[model samples]
Target: MRFILVNGMALRPRILCMLCCEPIGAHYLKEFSTGLSFCGHDCYALYCGRWISRAEQVKCPAVAETSC
Candidate 1:
């Protein structure tokens, strides 16, 4: 989770992109399983294909052979 200073109040940002670490306000991508957010479809694809499980990685278009 991440917070930002707004109107002198610290509040959680509307969106926190796990891939690029950007604070996205709208049109962001979300992964339902872990409630993870990404700045865009590309970021989400990278995370979903690499950060999580092998099953998801196969579904990604840019699949690569990797070791856990």
Candidate 2:
């Protein structure tokens, strides 16, 4: 949750991208699992890829070895 400012005054509420922190307007992408919104598909894909990498890193060594 964020806000738009005008002349140093808060004017309206806004939704910012979870990854880039850019304000999103009427149209945006949302990740249901995390309730995170993205400015565009590119940002969304980047976030998803980031999560995938994190998941990979947290795998147990024995489980990872067995999966291969």
For candidate 2, give the lDDT: 0.61
lDDT of each: 0.56, 0.61
TM value for model 2: 0.63
Candidate 2 Cα outliers beyond 4 Å, as residue runs: 1-12, 60-68
Best by lDDT: 2
lDDT value, candidate 1, whole model = 0.56
Tens digits of lDDT, candidate 1, 1-68: 12221233222545567999887654565555566666767776676556546655466634443322
The estimated TM-scores of all candidates read 0.51, 0.63
